[model samples]
Target: MSKELEKQGWVKRTTIDEPRLSEIVSEYKSLGYEVHLEPVHLEDVDAQCKKCYENQSDKIKTVYVRKRKQA
Candidate 1:
């Protein structure tokens, strides 16, 4: 007999505020789903950069979410 393949799925999110993120994550948890947060940081940010590298190191913060374990 041949084996059957199972399908999988998940949710992805873009940059969001802390309170909203928490509310969404809590909802997912209540639904018995797994939540994953990915932090994205970039250097040499145009806005955050300083006059000289010695003065400051630029960085950008962003977040992504992934929800899994759905029926």
Candidate 2:
């Protein structure tokens, strides 16, 4: 599992994996960066990809992950 944040107008990237993802989010938030996370299902993969591309192009960063769905 991994999480990435794309800041507005930044071409470079920062990647974080499980355990670290949570830590990074907290760190970024403490630094005053707005952060969000959404559970992504396999069925919604395409939509999620599109969203990441569009939003990221506009300076919004996103993290992609394949997590087991909760029962």
Candidate 3:
């Protein structure tokens, strides 16, 4: 899915906590971008970072954004 998104021009932005997710999403939308969010996946994390997200994955999200195609 990540590869598919990248192929479609969606750039991975950041993985963030839910607390600031809405604010960031709104910012991207306001800037005319199409934003997509996915729950953090185990494979998405580095071995060292996996521990931190193992139990908190549900509280975090992976952010991807792409410019809206002009009609």
RMSD after Cα superposition, model 1 = 10.1
Residue-level lDDT of model 1, residues 1-71, one tens digit each, is 00121122334444344567677667867866666554432242244332333342222123333445447
Model 3 stretches astray by more than 4 angstroms = none
Question: Can you tell me which runs of candidate 1 are displaced by over 4 Å?
Answer: 1-9, 40-71
Clashes of each: 0, 2, 0
Cα-based lDDT for every prediction: 0.43, 0.44, 0.89
TM-score (C-alpha) between model 1 and the true structure: 0.41
What is candidate 3's local distance difference test score? 0.89
Best candidate per lDDT, number?
Answer: 3
Residue 25 CA error for candidate 2 (Å)? 0.5
**Better candidate number, 1 or 3, judged by lDDT:** 3
What's every prediction's RMSD, in angstroms? 10.1, 13.9, 1.5
Quality of model 2 by C-alpha lDDT: 0.44
**How do all models score by TM-score?**
0.41, 0.33, 0.85
Q: What is the lDDT of residue 7 in candidate 3?
A: 91
Which of the two candidates, 1 or 3, achieves a greater TM-score against the reference? 3
* Candidate 2: segments with Cα more than 4 A from true spot: 1-13, 36-71
